[model samples]
Target: MAGFDIGEKWPFALAAILMGATFFIHLVAGGRQAVRPLLADSGTVPLDARMTLYYAWHVVSIWLAFATLIFFLAAFRPEFEAIAWANGVMAAAFGILAVVVTVLKRLPAAMLPQWVLFLPVAGLAIWGAIR
Candidate 1:
């Protein structure tokens, strides 16, 4: 918030880019290794790009999104003047698109954490609208 303009093009875009980069990294990293925290022991099957793509792009994209929320809350919280209809549109778009696509696809329930479906993208939307 000190030097950032949350509602402005530069700071918001920078944050979004950082979020995107984080998502991409998680996708390529095959969150399986990353997800090991939840597993009982090591030894897991190798996954191809498709696996990487889903976990990384599909899953990590949603998971790391919280960072984007936090970044905005910390960086752009001061920019209330910037929070407007455009930001609202972005929030709705992102939250809806991701959740809708995943649900409509009927993605296999087994491959994901049970609560993964309930992640609060609405929080991101709220953060976006606030900033």
Candidate 2:
């Protein structure tokens, strides 16, 4: 944490930006993708809004948690590196889980990019936290 607050520590800032971007893209785009099909035939049939809502909540909750870790890393406000490490581990775990869930849910191919993008974000966050 010696250079945590300095501009010289670009990695932490980059990791935060990447992770935040990942969360933003996934939250907005993924939500649209999940909800589209449900709303497609809403006029003709009883759309299962529950499924779309479920995905939205799940993605938001997970990515937001991960985003918090990235933000913490960027801000470098933690008094203890251990706390950052803990959040980093959680972020990485959820990053992996996001990929798995994306495939398991059989979502559109477009949604896969965000999960794939998250891998690097997760790696950077962990690296920043530990380094």
Candidate 3:
């Protein structure tokens, strides 16, 4: 906590909090709402497909957790800024993809509101990086 100056790097701190919250929501709520159902489909969904999707889900979980830690570290250590930028770009990409998919698939925006969660985290990370 010695070099953790929230006043100077509040954006990164805020980004970390948001990312952390998002990670937990994805892990817990998504597991219950999405993964559980996917796993429960014994006959309809193929085992290989289900397992592949499950692997991808955990990959995302790991990425979110890593980014959260990197953002927290970047809030205190200037050296981690590059990593923050990388994570920010990835976050922005995720947000943009959500919007693109919603529009292209003719799905309701509210149905795939990932952009609402990710874009702000991207914005905060970029803001903190350049601050």
**True-vs-predicted CA distance for residue 45, candidate 2, Å:** 11
- TM-score of model 1 (CA atoms): 0.31
Global local distance difference test of model 1: 0.47
Among all windows of 10 consecutive residues in model 1, the one with the lowest summed lDDT is 113-122
Query: Ranking under TM-score, best-scoring first?
Result: 3, 2, 1
Q: Which candidate wins on TM-score?
A: 3
What lDDT tens digits, residue by residue, belong to model 1 across residues 71-108?
45544555442442244344455556656666778876
Between 2 and 3, whose TM-score is larger?
Answer: 3
The TM-score of candidate 2 is: 0.59
- Model 3, 46-95: lDDT tens digits are 89999999999999999999999999999888888889988999999999
Q: Estimate each model's TM-score.
A: 0.31, 0.59, 0.93
Which stretch of 10 consecutive residues in model 2 shows the poorest summed lDDT? 78-87
Candidate no. 3 TM-score: 0.93
lDDT (C-alpha) at residue 5 in model 1? 58
For candidate 2, write residues 52-123 as lDDT tens digits: 676666866585666656455555654534554555566677667777877899877555565565566566
Clash pairs (backbone) in predicted model 2? none
